[model samples]
Target: MERDILHLTVPTFPITLARIAEPSLRERPVAVAPLTSERAVIQCASLEARAEGVCEGVSVY
Candidate 1:
């Protein structure tokens, strides 16, 4: 029934898949950072950045 509404073969996976599952994140430049804390790192990035030779810990600055 729920599958019929979403037209998904496995609709549940998308919800808990990962931040990488966010459609808006696909093929876009993004990263996780800290504001005040001095110890943090990027958790994930989109396919676009990977294509551009970017990845976690590649400082944008």
Candidate 2:
């Protein structure tokens, strides 16, 4: 028997959702983080943000 599987993914889920909420952030360095905490980690980073060395798990402060 043979089985086939397909995998699909969004380029970047957090960034995609952010851009949907705020189109102006598109082309800008964007980081997905929780605003409820003063010391939250960056959950995701946009392409522009990564270019500047920003990444997931980075400190929000």
**Distance from true position, residue 56, model 2, in Å?**
0.9
Error of 1 at 48 (Å): 0.9
Question: lDDT per model, in order?
Answer: 0.51, 0.87
TM accuracy, model 1? 0.36
Scored by lDDT, model 1 comes in at 0.51
Q: Where does candidate 1 clash, by residue pair?
A: none
> For residues 1-61, what per-residue lDDT tens digits would candidate 1 score against the true structure?
3554455464223323544467665445555544555666544554555577656764444
lDDT of 2: 0.87
Instruction: List candidate 1 segments past 4 Å from native.
Output: 1-27, 57-61
Q: Tell me how far the alpha carbon of residue 48 in candidate 2 is from the true structure, in angstroms, after superposition.
A: 0.6
Candidate 1 displacement at residue 30 in angstroms: 1.9
Q: Which ten residues in a row have the lowest lDDT in candidate 1?
A: 10-19
Model 2 regions more than 4 Å off: 1-11
